[model samples]
Target: MKKLIAIIPLLALCACWYSFTLKPYPDIDTVFVDSFANETDRFELPSAITEGLIGELHSGSILKLATRERAHSVLSGTVTHFGSEAYTYTAGEEPLDFRVTVRARVRFERAGADSPFWDYTVEGFATYPMDESTKSESQAIDEAVSMLISRIMDRLRTG
Candidate 1:
């Protein structure tokens, strides 16, 4: 009889905690990053951003999903817009370089969560000289976008 009373209070406490505070999230494995949508004509990037996204997700024990239904989280986003502006870059000694400013909105969410959602914009600028090699330019842009996704993951994991 005494055990029943004790168990009742224990269950009540568990229920209260569940109702009041968010549970700790385990690291999610699979994520789907869909292709860029709503892309514009000028300064357009390839549909290959999806592949870049998946490669980034490969770090830290995460897996990329081929289908949305199989993933633990679905990261679907519209490009909304990818805008760029030219700026003077004065990096090296001889000649001043050029710079491009890039901006995009990335929306993220867990598949089953009802209360919380992630929606934000990440902006960054990269500078390259007029005579910069093609490989260098590609690598620079890849780093910027990868950094943006890392920040998004950190927010989702902690928030």
Candidate 2:
């Protein structure tokens, strides 16, 4: 009977953890994110990458921090790989058609005694007609990143 009583406490302690709890997209107190580390030998990556992500997080209203050190979560990432083939004509071809792919990833770290650590990754891509202008291509990348972050937040809400 004493052993059974002791085991009861153990079982309760084990149950305290939640592997699949629908944690409300953690109300991030603050988040610090790392910029994309260039890994491609091709074009130079944009500098606004970090700023854009910061803007996304701000828009999402997930977390706010006066400084990176004060953030409860830290976000960082490396430009794993990026490349794209001409979906249609390469360039200077009549009725030019092409697709530019921007692949980037970000991860988040949260510190909490009662909350489980969480990591989120997001990627996005956009395609437009040729002659859409470089700005458009750039916009596509930002949009993709934005979409990815949104999805991550959505996942947090559900899981």
Candidate 3:
């Protein structure tokens, strides 16, 4: 009788854990990530952001990558803004660093669904020091892109 009681509690714990770990999009098997629309004046920003997101999706392996026609869901995004501002100054009053920020509206929707699964605006920032070892504009943009991708994934996984 004691062993049975302990086994019941263990089974209950397992059930609760399983339910907690269940993902919302279990039926979604494939995704298509579209080229992002660039509203910013920066050249190649859209391609770079799109490539970064595709890289993340490929690495995650949570969803298979597919062409738009074969996808279970499609993800589209628009770069609403991107800019860099001087963040720090050198001791001689020279520009020491700059912070780059990018904001985007992202939508992930199921194929043929009435509404989007997720729609939101996400922003990311990175600081680039303007020194001998300073990163270039592209590097700063890459960092921001990665940050934005991470935020999107977190929201998707949790919600």
lDDT, model 3, position 38: 86
Residue 131 shift from truth in candidate 2, angstroms: 4.7
Clashing pairs in 1: none
Ranking 1 against 3 by TM-score, winner? 3
Against the true structure, whose TM-score is highest?
3
**Per-residue accuracy of model 3 over 1-159 as CA lDDT, tens digit each:** 999998999999999987886466888878899999988897677787788778878886577789999999988899999989888987988888889999999999998788999899999899888762868867888889889888977776666
Report the CA-based lDDT of candidate 2 relative to the real structure. 0.58
As for candidate 3, its clashing pairs are none
What is the TM-score of each predicted model, taking all chains together?
A: 0.58, 0.58, 0.80
Predicted candidate 1 versus true structure: per-residue lDDT over 27-47, tens digit per residue: 566677767564655344435
Tens digits of per-residue lDDT, candidate 2, 1-159, equal: 999999998887777755543354456667676666766663444344566666766775545643666777766666555555456664566555445555555555674334445544455555655677654666655565556556655553454
Please give the range of 10 consecutive residues that has the lowest summed lDDT in model 1: 40-49
Cα error, candidate 2, residue 121 (Å): 4.9
By TM-score, rank the candidates, best first: 3, 1, 2
